[model samples]
Target: MKLSLFIFLAAAVLGPELCLATLHNITVKGELLCDNATVSNVKVELREHDTFDPDDTINAVHTDSSGRFEIFGEEDERKLTTFYLRIFHKCDATHPKVCTRATEYDVPEKKLDSVYDMGSISLNLQDNKELGRRYDRDSEECD
Candidate 1:
């Protein structure tokens, strides 16, 4: 029957569309750097901006010895997303100032239509000295 044939064709078309909307796993690999140099033991996080809580964190990762990191995630198309690579120096027990404050680097969101290869996402901690100075000024004023 023509009705049966039409129904079958409709299912075939709709099935692929439904599957395409599902999230696929992605691998993102990159180098972590500080002050334009390679850094080890850095923390990397894949955070989703939630509508309910703006400042709440979702997921996190850490870098290896060579400053290389890989994160597996499903790309979401509905919302604006970004991953952050955070760098922190190992601190001594007695001297807090010996370790630099944590710095965040933004990772570009992957698109749903394509696979993402992060390649080399470089970070520069010293490049924002002015921003750090501004923070110090605000803290001094608060005190």
Candidate 2:
């Protein structure tokens, strides 16, 4: 009888918290440019940032011939999901210190479950807070 009561009390206390997971969906679209010209085939990844857990990749895509892209994804999370876009490209890489330049753009939480259009982004411009650079050893080319 004591064990049964304890279990019932525990369930009453934690049931709501355990069942608070929500499904979040987002659509991200943008145009990529380099030196005022459209950059095609650039890789873009939508990701979720987690606390005390490994980050998750929601979706990934490449820019079209017109440098346009639209990607969407959904996930169920107990806490509010944080999202960002990771762009990988080889723009303005004359020295080619790395295989590609990676940049991140944070998505507004208010844009959840809706389309977030990130107007034109120029890769030639300096990335004020660049995430980092990508180095691929298998690639035999660097320019």
TM-score per model over all chains: 0.47, 0.82
- Runs of candidate 2 with Cα error greater than 4 angstroms are 1-15, 136-143
Show how many residue pairs clash in every candidate, following the order shown: 1, 0
lDDT of 1 by residue, 44-142 (tens): 655444566563344566778887877666544334545444444332112433334455555555543344555554554245211242223234322
Over 1-143, each residue of candidate 2 has an lDDT whose tens digit, in order, gives 99999999999998988899999999999899998999998989999999998899999999999999999999898999888998888887656356677788889999999999999989877644476556563465333
| Candidate 1, pairs of clashing residues | 35-125
TM-score of 2: 0.82
Query: Looking at candidate 1, what is the lDDT of residue 139?
Result: 43
**Where does candidate 1 stray beyond 4 Å?**
1-26, 35-37, 55-58, 75-100, 110-115, 125-143
Cα shift from native, residue 111, model 2 (Å): 0.8
